[model samples]
Target chain A: MLSLLRPGSNPRRELEAAAIALLLSIAIGSLLMLAAGVSPGRVWFAMIERTAGDPYLLGQVLYKATGLALCGLAVALALDAGLFNIGVEGQLSAGVLACAVTGASLPESTPGILAIPLCLAAAAAAGAVVGASIGALRAMRGAHEVITSIMLNAIVAGVSLWIGNEVLFQGGTTRGNTIVEGAQLPLLPMSGSSVNAALVLALVVVAIVWFLRVRTTWGRTWIAVGQEPAAARAVGISVARVQTLVMAGSGALAGLAAANFVMGHKHAFEEGLGRGTGFLGISVALLGRSHPVGVLLAAVLLGLLSSGGLAVGDLVPKELMEMLQGVVVLSVAAAGPWVARRSVTVVPEVAA
Target chain B: MTTARLMRVASLALAACVLLCAGALFYGGSAYALERWITGGVALAVVGVACVVAGAFGSTAMRIAAVIVAAAAIAGAVLETATHSELFVAVASTAFGAQALKIAIPYALAAMGGAVTERAGVIDLALEAKLLFGAFTAAAVGYASGNVYVGVAGGVLAGMAVAALQLGLALRLTADQVIVGVALNLLALGGTRFLLQLIFHEGANSPPSPAFENTVLSNPIFWLAVAAAVLVPLAMLHTRWGLRLRAAGDRPEALVAVGASPSRARFAAGLVGGALAGAGGAQLSLSVGGFSADMSSGRGYIALAMVILSGWRPAWAAIACLGVGGAEALEIQLQVTGSGVPRELAPLLPYVLTLIVIIIAGGKGSAAPRSLGRVS
Candidate 1:
């Protein structure tokens, strides 16, 4: 089970395959750009120059990466337990709502230190509740997590809309009131950038997750249950309990992503906060091969593409970037089994 | 505990919950509530209890009887909640029925597509993508050429294209079906949105295209969908081809012993299913007279759910689709009638109902295809 949890191939080989996939996706994207009557080279050059050369643009990448990394880690955690957490979108929505509500309710004079942690904790708990419900449904009702999670997404959308209209909406406005100043994370001392403390916090999360997964018995047991439930059961592990626990942990991680938008940037919840970021996390997990370190790198790469896509919207439509991301994920999925087969044949005699 | 006993207990619990909730609604001190509606709720609860008793103590016939009574009870509840006029109830139900038929056309077609493909063992999670691509191409072609037939053909071909991608990835290369399906969905969304923007210069909707606006009885696609639904089951039960398809999914080695390739059989099934789903999509866009990115919404997923809820059978799948459509139509009617249910929560009824039905059906006991998600 442990062996199955870890990839058999060397890290170098996996890295090489990832790089190739990225380049191929870019190539396909360029062809589409050409067909659309745009010059890919000019667009690529502009995107790179804007994102890498300018500090403000770089800050934007970091800001986006903070959210993506947390969500990516959330997905990786679920994947470690052999579960697909498609409800991350719904979970994140609930989390941001909880964070905003709690932040807004706090006294104005509350210390930033206490207020920030309280808001984050509230978001995590809210997300965990949502996640645990789906887990319970899967365990007790014989429901597929995929279908239930998707259903929860629709339910969350309706609930969020209702809450926004009835409870959160300020008088004559469409959005909730802003959080108190004490609850907001302090921004980095940089000119022309809104990058806040979330980036540092995201990195800390990544380190902690990595340690838990590699250096703890609990993580091993979770992975064991995921890889082979029947064997785990035979060995006296309660598969249901592990699944529920991992799912809650996964939800909490995804909920923490709300901090990037609610506390670090917008300081209030509204419709479309970090829209599509949840789905993007799935792709990042796949690209990173569901490893903590790999998820971080993939999130950063996607952050660059997204921020650059926005910067170069004039030269080529930003929709192209979206298409490219989809193309990359598809190409990787299509190639994964074949690559795994080849690597297995090459390695020869690895114990099953 | 044995699964059957577990299911029986769950069904009993559901019945008890229904009765308890109904009793609370009827007897609770609401000053302005109607007596007739409360009586109707109690009647529904009685039928639910009868079903639970049959499930616990009766034979298969009794269990089926219980299911029928439960279904009727649901219909009664909907009628009571959505309409108040006893004199006009008949008239209102006719209108609601027509709306349900209209809403159900796409679902029936899509669910049929799902049922057939899943029976052959290649998971069709890309149904959503196929629907989106089909809708877009159908609208675009119809608008450009001024012929509905061309549009329909475009839709069919577009669906086949998406199926071909699934076939290559899932069958040929043996990629994870779920992952490939998700990727295809994302691709379809992005690709369609990009093209819609590029050609229409609009972010949301396309120009109005020609459409079939005939009454339900006169609509050709509606009949086509119904015929497909009826014939698929007959074909599955009586035909040699049907046997081979089932064999391919349930016991591919037996199929291999007979000198037939399971992969080829699955490929053919996927193609036919894709075409049907595409027709559903084409009909959707035509009904609305234009294409919108969010038009299909989650109908494809709902169709997938219907297949499971129906226990992998075609006729029952059709029934499930009608139920979902009715639920949706009732939601709309409730808003029109000022039934006082929170409007924001009304749209979620169909999805929540699907989840409940699946849970009651007891998960893996739904008689799924044996090798459904396995790679050959």
Candidate 2:
């Protein structure tokens, strides 16, 4: 999507591109709903009414959004470095297992301050190991990160499944043993929903990402390397090191998503835990256009859509929300380039 | 006719007849020891041909080793066919061959389509979307119309429609092909379920409908797949359309030099490729009796992998599909027969093997189109 725009363009134009994409998806989604014999207005109203009207549902949305935001940040950061990290799903899977195992192994009387960070650190470290290995493959061996990441994802899935089936969940049940109680993130005041401190962490990360992108030299270095690798190399920047580091950073952020699931929601590593969030991160990053603020907003909007689909499930299939995300990304991608091209052509006329 | 010319014709006819008879007897069992003889004979011939093909690649030592392995496999298969023909017949029976064909056909078709799409410089990751749309439309239309052929037409058109969307975005709108492709696949999965709910009033599957009597014997789409597997690469090497398509992938500027539009050639490639892929989708539904939502099950992606692994050759992609199908079939057999590898791990063999092969082969003499994934 960044490729569709001018390098280092005004942020407002990028916002406009994202807005146009959203509006287009809304229009298409409404048409689909109408075709399904559902009243679009009522459906949307019900969706908003149930998802955001009730504190419980709103809390659920927030819980979902926390993970999506972290994942969005991961993908957005990688996108900024010109590395498409489709392996976020795999990284998150690794993190979830590691986090669960770490929490389970800690003494039963472990304190929150000690246990939580240790588990989270284990998650991030596991994820970084996966993320950096793929990074090294792309950096040193010149393999396309996309293919290697996908292969890595498949491997992670197989290994995780094997471990989960054999070692973690020894009983007939598919769910793993619970983490120490101290390691769990305290639930928010919302009615019985799993919203917790992870939401705060996600928001903090968003702000951090914003500050890094706008104010940090390292951030600029990655963007520079992304845009012009040879030029960066001419300036004595190590492109390989930067990419590998950025990818590892991306993987760690994705790993942070496990806190929301393991520490807040499930408190255990379950098979099929948080499935599809990694791919949804791609959608968020694309829809967000790789911006920190944009990613945060996109994550909330998508989380609302996911929860809202269930809210309005009786009127239309919840699957429509999934389709809507696809429509959103495709419209965004298609419109990005066309709008940019038009803007380019219009600039001369403006000068005249 | 001249005596020599007639003799040559007679010899050719005789060879064809023997091949057909052997293939029939190998799959369709016989009363006598003749079945065993035919099975062994076919096995040896297949292994011999494999050895010759393997000889085309690898160092001299590797080639020699592969040949020795091929010889051992051939001798083992023949001996097994003679005494315990159960193993050979299990793999080569009419039922098993049909199942493998069913498994391979859709993948082969999609892979061939992927070969054309990627070879023409468009990275087609949404082969799934096209195939899914094809399958759903074929099932829906075929059930509604009670006419299988018309349903197949609907599927083919559906595939082309999806192709046009991809091309419009990737080529005209200059969107990122991989992103568009991925988004389209997600949309296809969800959209098909949405449509299924709307049309069939169910999300899981559609009602069963009339289908082809025999895919191998009578299905037009099956023959089309066969033709695509055999003819696409030959056309790539020979035809004007083929040359222009290659140029579109390798050097779009060369087409401009010749006063031709590479975009046009690419569009042409998309049309042909989309239709074949769509037909595969139709075959999937029609052969299976109905469409299950998103039933292609990553076959389209695997087909794309095979396309890349085969270095963009349609024939090799089809062969790769066969290999994948064979592994899957063997995995099923292993579940029943039991094995050292966990039954759970058996299914991972094809995917893991493909990944390993790709890693080994990716760096050396990469044959991907020069301007691949670049929207010009």
- Model 1, first chain, TM-score of 0.93
Q: Which residue ranges in model 1 land beyond 4 Å of their true spot?
A: A1-10, A346-352, B1-30, B33-91
Return the lDDT, model 1, position B63: 35
Error of 1 at B272 (Å): 0.9
Model 2: per-residue Cα lDDT over B16-73, one tens digit each: 3433433442334446556556655665465444444433453333333443344344
lDDT for A5 in candidate 2 is 32
lDDT of 2 by residue, A1-352 (tens): 2465323667777888899998898899999999988889989888897876799999988988999999988988888877778889999999998999999888999999999999989989988888987776566544556666666777678778878887888479888889999999998999998899999989988999888887989889998877778889999999989999999989999888999999988988899787778878888988888888889999999898888888888898877887887898898888788767777744443210
Give the whole-model CA lDDT for all candidates, comma-separated: 0.77, 0.77
- The interface RMSD value for candidate 2 stands at 10.0
What is candidate 2's fraction of native contacts?
0.48
Candidate 1 TM-score versus the reference: 0.91
lDDT of 1: 0.77
